[model samples]
Target: MLTIRRHLVDAIVEHARKDHPDEACGVIAGPAGSDRPERFVPMLNAARSPTFYEFDSMDLLHLYREMDDNDEEPVVIYHSHTATEAYPSRTDIGLANEPGAHYVLVSTRDEDTHEFRSFRIVDGEVTEEEVQVIDGE
Candidate 1:
């Protein structure tokens, strides 16, 4: 299960909505081994496609360096799907490299509704997981 704060979830949804037709991608980093998402790092989707998301290689590298300096690890890796369900696509599965991270998908297919789902993708296998949102720290 992925245990996260309500505000963090809201931020992700808001970012997704802001990106609208384009897919929004980002990461929530926390202390190493914490499995707790405490920092929100919104990223630019290099692909800028409605059906796909790709973190800018340079930005991703910088993020990794920053995380290392802070002793942090990505707890939640998230992206938005503008016209599809909140589920991982084959590309997403194939790109999954963080076996310990929670892969979060937010679907903004409906104007008035959205779907937020979490999964574990390890070695090309995807498993849906429960999300528990709390009041916050």
Candidate 2:
């Protein structure tokens, strides 16, 4: 099972809604352990593509360096599907380099609006996981 903060889910939905026609992306940071293998703090990357997201290499480098400085590693990567379901695309699967990190998808294609899902892609295989959003104190 995958667990995420409620605020993180809201932020992802908001980002997806705000980015409408394009894809919005960001990073998830937290502890990845057996007891809580998927707990994260979502960080919105203001730097994103309006038509296509090509993970800003500079921003990625900065984020990595910052994480190193703070001693917190990026445990997951999230992106939105403006018009499609919350699932990985072929390109997404092909470009995913982190086998141990969670891949989250937020879908904003319906009238009700918010939908979030999490998955893991390893060796070209995609496995969906249940996400339980926990309200933080």
C-alpha RMSD by candidate, in order: 0.6, 3.0
Instruction: Pick out the ten consecutive residues of candidate 2 with the lowest summed lDDT.
Output: 32-41
Q: All candidates' TM-scores?
A: 0.99, 0.83
RMSD of 2: 3.0
> Model 1: clashing residue pairs?
none
Candidate 2 Cα errors over 4 Å, as ranges: 31-51
How displaced is residue 128 in candidate 1, in Å? 0.4
Writing each residue's lDDT as its tens digit, candidate 2 over 52-137 gives 45666777787778767766666668888777788999988997888877788887778486678898999889999888889873
**List of clashing residue pairs for candidate 2:** none
Task: Give each model's whole-structure lDDT.
Answer: 0.97, 0.72
Model 1: per-residue lDDT, tens digit, 46-81? 998998899999999999999999999999999999
What overall lDDT, based on C-alpha atoms, would model 2 receive against the true structure? 0.72
Q: Relative to the unseen true structure, what is the C-alpha lDDT of residue 4 in candidate 1, on a scale of 0 to 100? A: 97
